[model samples]
Target: MSSKEKLNDAFSTISDSFLTECARPLKKTVFQKRICRLLPLVAVLVSIAILLPIAVFRHKSDLIPGRWTLISHADETVRKEMLVESAHKPTVSMSMNYNKLPAEQAEAVGFSPEKDPCVELFAQWFYSQITYDYRMHFSLFQKEAVDYSFTSEAIERGFTFESALDKLDTVTSHFYNGIKYDLFYSLVSCKDLTAELENTQGQFYKSIVRCGADPAKISMIVEYTFDDIKLIMNERFLNTSPDGERFNFMFYCYDGHWYIFETEMENDFSIDVLGKDEDWLSILIVPQECYGRVVAVGRGYLLLDNGEYFMTLDELDLKVGDYVHVSFTGFQTKGRFIADDGSTEQKVTCNNLLTVKLAEPSTPSEEERSNE
Candidate 1:
């Protein structure tokens, strides 16, 4: 009676305890399933709250605050064709004058007397002048000039021949400040030791010379034109050629002025100098008037009363309530121009037309807002 009764009592107590624990867990499981079903709805509401602000911020229409409409050309066929032509164009090579230095001067600019001493002096001098001013330096030869001319060869290219010529002229002008005609004239008038070799018209000697200050050290470059060679020797060498490469013919800035120490030229054309990078952001500004608001610091929009006018940011330095003259391209809208005639809708030329200010910021609403 003792062993059997004790075993049965222990089994019954264990069964009751297990059933009570299972009942609590079952209830918890049901509650967790219900929460899982509602989680998606809560997540969707949270996402909506996060996206609303972004949507409102991007809602730009009619040029209103928090809304903007940018008008850009959708057809880029012309631009693409122009870009392709530009990419495939061949580069132009410029020839420098090494014979500008005579045989004696060539030895002075690190040019070996054993080698072609005549041109070595000129090459040495040219290299020194170029390396001296890295920012404004142009290689004695510009590859872009050739490249541009090559690109312009394609007749179907977007820009006209005149336009291409204009661009080339613009780029070349950046190399030197003097007028092209005057420079050419001066080169023709210069006389030097090489000029003594010229017998008559069209008989020219091509030489490069480096002549500056020191007689021992010199720079070397190549020369092809007799006039350029003579100009260098007459203006730069003081009518005398250095004896050996011991002279420093390279120009050094002394007291903010460029002074040549010595001179020489190389006979070979293998010397390489890096080309100048193009200025992409070059722009011309024109004055014009348009309606714009000083909405915030450093922010303003020039609005044209004529709906079709559009201008580039590069064309004008605009400010709030400042009257300016502007020219733009767009369609025309029929509008009443307040003139001697009271009020009559007139067909106005809008697209790509020059606009003169009829008045400054005169809208009552804009004035009230400004006061606020």
Candidate 2:
């Protein structure tokens, strides 16, 4: 037989066998008839069960766009009102001395005028030192924590002004609450470029921050020209080593638009990285009374209220009746040390001294001793 005829025969045989078995059961009267009647109902219930979840999901999905639109409109209204209020406030402008080096003092600091032409040479030196130190302490690119990765070289090669602007558009569309908003304003507010050229090494663009309440809070928008960017890039490359000592540059490109190239600096000085103060006397102290009435046993340590003095726990040098300040950390209480145990080997009582004064005096009502 031909292949098609063989397949047809196989299907016919299976159907005939199934029908014969079904007929045999139907021959058993009421039982067969009841199953035959319930089969159609069971099929219908199974179809509905499969389709129910899909129908519900489709219904909810249809409502999402409308819900998002309402939320967005509400947010825009609040932001508009805040911007208007912020604009009416008086703005204060203070020149931040970016270059803190004195021109006359450059000779004493071994700064050769030819090598370091900038007058603020000392400030530059300090800035470079701090920046390098911070980078060394903290690796700029934490690869383990990052979701996306790129290098400064890749950013430089891939990026163009047009591309960056396009990426900025995409960024603003998605991340309107962050840097995108700031960049959008910066581009829109780029006014006259009549400022006299100071440095030929880089091109500079500045925009006035119009949306902030305080001038100090307002950011001065500046974009370093390509040459400036290249200089910074070259310096970074030379400073960074191949042994993972360098920072990774991450760039976001949207619709062929490239955003700013940012590398995690080794030392992010903008954060607090200072160590704890070791000198006890120089530490600022507060007294226990400053904190709410001490319900349980509490201890305070010696603190230096004055900026100059240093305090130590050495019993050999410090004695009872010596004037000193004690500060307890959590309680926010600072007091003068009045008395101490003469022996250095034992635990001393600093709380009972007369010289100790509460940084914040308790209200007289709370100060009254309760007659128990």
Candidate 3:
């Protein structure tokens, strides 16, 4: 074959597109090289942008267990306006369907959880405590007191007031958001209770909770059970204040009466200058175990032969004569009672009883021996 005949054969084998300059490899620019290198990163960013919100939207609700409707303030934001606070704060509300609750618990919560008498009582208790409106729930329970020292401290904190009422805006805003939610878990949470109870209860007794008079028991009129109590407040109410970020006022049912048994409050600064995180919470004390003889048992009170009195939440079929071993969250609050003779007695309230076991019989106390 001649050279011309061989070239014609090769050209016939190759396509016309490949034979053109358009199919030839060209030198890439620096910008094109950078873009090529960034392709994978750009793809990853696009994926994240599309997926992150969907993941959030599909996230489950973590509100308290059970079906509940707000009966008090209609909405959290509306509730804030009613408080003594002066600042305009927008509250974020969460609606929940309580899952994993025991059947009995679900029934106890009822169709309208807010209708629980304790919830109403708690609402009144919180309002009176927050507004210092003793006139609100007159005769229902003993009124909550403010430390007069707060007045002097407010000045020390560089706050001034025309009247006592005028001071709450700055004072409350710095210390609290004036919003709260209630939850009832049959088993008490010892985690936060034991940690803060001692210091705050001590301060409370020193300044306020010391009482010689029996607190008037307010009847709910409705047969609502007051157990498994939690009042989740907006964060950063000072950890030690009487009306703090959580469980502003807690009550226990004893002798068919609702009595204020525990309280946690915000720090005095009413200012975030304390350098705590936005979601900062109270410290938790280590739990403990105790073995004792049940000298007395009532609806809300548990007393041991050893003179320890506990306001406990337990599912045990406890009787007055039983000897048992108990695992509990540590003590935090002490109810101080004054006697007519001017002597003072203190009683510590312990809760979050994780477990109770019937232990081998221990020796009887001298008091128990005498009572027998």
Q: Please list the C-alpha lDDT of all candidates, in the order they appear.
A: 0.25, 0.22, 0.35
lDDT of 2 by residue, 34-59 (tens): 10011111111111110111111122
TM-score of 2: 0.15
What candidate 2 gets wrong by more than 4 Å, as runs, is 1-145, 148-258, 268-305, 308-372
Minimum summed lDDT over a 10-residue window in model 3 is located at: 33-42
Residue 191's lDDT in candidate 2: 15
* Steric overlap count per candidate: 74, 18, 13
Q: CA lDDT of 81 in candidate 3?
A: 11
Deviation in angstroms for 117 in model 2?
33
* Superposition error at 216 for model 3 (Å): 6.0
Residue 221 displacement (Å), model 3: 15
Candidate topping TM-score? 3
How far residue 191's Cα lies from its native spot in candidate 3, in Å, is 16
Q: What is the lDDT of candidate 1?
A: 0.25
Candidate 1, residues 307-357, lDDT tens digits: the string is 322312223344445444554332222222212222223222222224434
**Residue 15 deviation, candidate 1, in Å?**
70
